[model samples]
Target: MVDAKDLSLAPRLLPISLSVEAGQVVHLIGPNGSGKSTLLELLSGLEVPQSGSVWLQGQPVSGQTRYDLAQVRGYLMQQQRPAFVMVVFEYLNLVLDSVQLATGEIRDKAVADVVSRLAISDKLHRRIDSLSGGEWQRVRLAGVLLQVSKALNPHACLLLLDEPSTGLDVAQQAVIYQEITALAREQEIAIIMANHDLNRTLEHADTVVVLQQGRIVSLGPPKAVLTDRLLSDVFATPLEQVSTANGPVIMRASSS
Candidate 1:
């Protein structure tokens, strides 16, 4: 469990007191600059909160080395530009080889499987900078996957992705979400992803937390909370919506 007891990050996130349970897939949905990433950063301890405490699994999560916290959680920020200029596979290897695995072949095979699932198998030899934005995002996500798998046991991983679906096409986006769903179900990892894909996020999420102006506007089950009024109020725009055969689809109205 991640608890934010009156957490505050100045000039960024408004003070918030929120608690998210384990095995819950929650999406912090908000418009750009609505403190989604700031909330994430504060929770992940990338930025120190101005006030309050963060408790992970009932223990205070701060006052420790960043490397120590990495063991309990894995955070993927909004952007991960290539600073090292390494091959994609090498990066995967770097993440994969960090943990002490009993079998070399098994480790390599697992890394390969993760790369395949993220749809970056063909780009294994390509340098990160040489690939497109979406491809690099996948590679970085794959590295995250590998890192988490390598370090964490089942039922004890927190995957916090800030705007994960940003650069992907529809198919790629689906794959990314599917991967998240599988992790939550199969590995029992807690997932908190931020995205603008309201429909997809709602469909995949167990719960949705709506934020506006750094404040949590609403929090509940997706179907109950994703109403037109909530959408319009949180986004500060008139969002047209419909409950279709599938699920709630939020649309934008164009002035005609």
Candidate 2:
């Protein structure tokens, strides 16, 4: 669980407050530079807030050191490019080291489990730089999951993802969303993610927070927060939510 109150990050983000509970999936959606990423950074303790406070499970994030916070939350940024030459398995060993988990069959099993879940089992021996965009996304996500597993209570860990579905294709994006939902339901890991795909957010998010001009415009269920009027007003264009067999789809309004 996480909470933020009276949060301000200058022109990028105005004062805002929000809370996330265990087994919940909260989505932050807004236009470019609308403070989605800034909010995540604040919650993850990657950046100290200019004002307000972020609490993890009850304790103030400010009191926690960077390493201390890492144990409670796993964050995957929007842009993650491999900087050095390392194979997938080797990369995972580094993650395990940071978490202070032991290496051996135990670590091997952990890495295997994550890659298997993300369906990247064959890429363990491949270099990070050689992976396709989707493959790289899965690999990075696997590292985040690995970190959560090493937590004192994996189920209590918070997952903060910034556009996690960035490089994945449609099917792969669905897979990642499904995995996130499963993590919340089965593992009780609270997840807060920022995404540009409204439909995906609608399908998987337990709650949606709509931000505009660095302030919250609406926050509620997809149906309540993503109405025709709200979408049109927030985005400064005519928009509508159409109910289809699949689910609610946000679309541009027909001119006619």
Candidate 3:
């Protein structure tokens, strides 16, 4: 549903090309300054690349097409700052207000579904400024999801998230990832997320794109691309992949 061809943004992002199809969860994994955020911005049409092109749903992603693209794509940046002090429900209502919903019932159902999935039902009455880091992140995410939900935008086909699990604890992270995977599968939406946790990517991502110094080192299924040798070289550390009952885990290679 989304295609980026030879995308480049000066020194930060090098030539990159990739495509995301419906019901696919593509993860971008790399260390600091590897251009994960740059790539996402390019795909979201938040920033135009110096070279190459990004297309969403077959339309070129430029300032001219952003208005139409906005209806079908949801993007959550790594950092979010609340613009004003408002109740969680109020903030969410404002997001839904932008979309053309069928009726009050439809709006209510959309809000309920996103809040429940993000586990922020209890925070509806709370002020945005009063929530903890994790709570705030979930609220931000809920807003994005609600804006592009099928009830609001039946044409919704793409979701771009950057470090979505920023401040959440382990349990919360697990819940969020599960919800994310379900969203992609059930809604048939193509998802591209920049994540730091290799194990989490392995568990949830249908495909993995490993980056290093602003270029793609490897791209494929997590188990195939995230091998011990590749990760060790890309991360510039001694790392190993171990087999466990749960799944394959990436860890620092023990020095003995």
Candidate 4:
């Protein structure tokens, strides 16, 4: 569980309290400068909150050591900036290996299943350098999923994702949503993902948190919290909410 109790950041995020249970995906969304990324970093143990607490499983999130935290949570940052030369399958093997010292027995089957689901089975033997940007993100997500799953112990596996769809195509984004859903149900992973695309998050997330000026302006389920009136007031624009067969999608006009 991710229990953030009245946590505050550098100069904002005042009186913020949130609870996310296992088998759930909570989407954090707001404007570019709203400090969504900062909140994610705090939750991921990369940054410490100035006050209050970020609790995981029953302990403070920031109190854990970096190495110990990595075992319990898998965080995918907004940028896929790492440079690596390993093949896709080999990279997947490396992730599984990091799960434990005695993981060779279950490694093969786990890698096969994750790759197959991400639609990267064919790209397995190919070096990651040869794959496209979207392909690499899928590979990254597969690695994250495997790591979080391995860390589970009769409880939820926490995952922190910061704008993970930055470089993904529409189809690839769809696959990621599916994987997130399945992981919550099958592996009981609790995800707190910061998303720049509010439309996508509103449609799929179990909970939505909005940050503004480093503060949480709103937090709730999608339909209940995201309103055209609220968006207009916060974004200083006449935002439109269009209802599609899938769900509501917000559209913003350009200033130019």
Candidate 1: C-alpha lDDT: 0.79
* Candidate 4, number of clashes: 1
Model number with the top TM-score:
3
Q: Candidate 4: list runs displaced more than 4 Å.
A: 12-15, 150-156, 244-246, 253-256
RMSD in order of candidates: 2.1, 1.8, 1.3, 2.9
Model 2: residue 53 alpha-carbon error in angstroms: 0.5
lDDT preference between candidates 2 and 3, better one: 3
- What local lDDT does model 4 show for residue 214? 78
| Residue 86 in model 2: lDDT | 95
Alpha-carbon deviation at 173 in model 4, angstroms = 1.0
All candidates' lDDT scores? 0.79, 0.86, 0.87, 0.78
Q: Which residue pairs collide in model 1, if any?
A: none
Reference-based TM-score of each model:
0.92, 0.94, 0.96, 0.88
lDDT of 3 at 122: 97
lDDT of 4: 0.78
Clashes of each: 0, 0, 0, 1
Q: Show where candidate 2 strays beyond 4 Å.
A: 102-106, 150-156
